[model samples]
Target: MTFSLVGHCAETGQLGIAICSSSIAVGARCPWLQPGVGAVSTQNITLPALGPQVLEHMACGLSPTQALDSALTRNGYSQFRQLAAIDYRGRTAHFSGSETLGCHHTLPGELCVGAGNLLAGASVIEALVRTFETSGGQLADRLLAGMQAAVAAGGEAGPVHSAALVVVGELTWPIIDLRVDWADEDPVGKLAQLWAAYRPQMQDYIVRALDPTQAPSYGVPGDE
Candidate 1:
């Protein structure tokens, strides 16, 4: 059983996703991002290979929906797939196949959207969709809030296991990519807290990458 939300922030101007599941190590099955390209999440009877292939199609100028359609068409077992994609420009596309596990649904929104599978109930998806659209903030903040709403609405029926969040910019290698492969409990909360903690570090890293050799002037005695 699992409930996941994979989406990109339009104004954050980055591609990213937040995911969780009752399944052991769900991170291993979903979430993929490449800077300057696109983002993909292949799950729910997943055809994992499609994730990368979708990016290739998008790179060739195909829109999000067109890329998804072509990728699914090429898959031998398209009916069993639950996948979503978002391009660099914020266009979104998703497919929830007929053979999806149970109570599976995906909502496509303007700035963001989400897909859920093996859900505890229909409420999970509903809450996520509402949160994504109603939440006010930049893209990343909205995505995070939507995910927390889904978890609060009762996440996957199975025990909390693994969780992950990935974000990338036009040139940023990885602004945020944190994973809790297997947590005893509250993987989503842990992921949120982890993200909060890592944000500053990542920002610092970005700063360093952009212009290193500048040190913070804290407690420095008068230099000669």
Candidate 2:
């Protein structure tokens, strides 16, 4: 019931994940990323702990594939889990277990991995990877584009109600983290609108957190 992609931007050394699902609050469970470490998406039956475990393994110097393998081996029901990881160096790996629900596919690319279960078909994942590879702009933008492309190519077997986009740069906190917990309409598009509004002020928000005295004003009415 979920489709997700984990990606790295070689130019900026940023890592990110974009995901959508028919399930409620998919973002809070599926996507994980640590600055300078890696990005992981654990879906299918959705083992939330495995996402962080994979990140920790990568932080301990394991490659994406090695980390995924280690995580899978430790799980008793590995057959129900779908996993994907992309390391700091942009090496990518993915696994869709044999028992994943409905149709599923994982497309591992040079700097990204796209995976999905209970999807429209292989074309969903295909469009995700292809769009991510060809689209330009920030890493977050490309990730969103990939998500949009998946929907265009026929997204989840059912309508997707929740979506998320997360990107981390060189900070302790994510550079971009947006989610639509549940929406009757297009959650991905709602996320895109949030990104558009957030893009110009993202740096300002960080600056405020790091040094408020030097931060810009509210840019609102009557503040002076």
The number of clashing residue pairs in each candidate reads 0, 0
Give me the runs in candidate 1 sitting further than 4 Å from their true place: 215-224
- Look at candidate 1 and give me any clashing residue pairs: none
lDDT of 2 by residue, 92-164 (tens): 9899888999999999876999999999899999999999999999999999999999999999899889999
- TM per model? 0.88, 0.97
Pairs that collide in candidate 2 are none
RMSD of 1: 3.2
- Which ten contiguous residues of candidate 2 have the minimum total lDDT? 215-224
Candidate 1 on 1-224: residue-level lDDT in tens? 55556566655567877788776667677887777678888888766688888999999999989998998898778888888788888788888878888777788777565888877778887788789788876555667788889888877666778888888886647777788888889888888889778865666677767776663433458932
Candidate 1's TM-score:
0.88
- Candidate 1: lDDT over CA atoms? 0.77
Candidates' RMSD to native: 3.2, 1.2
Candidate with top TM-score is 2
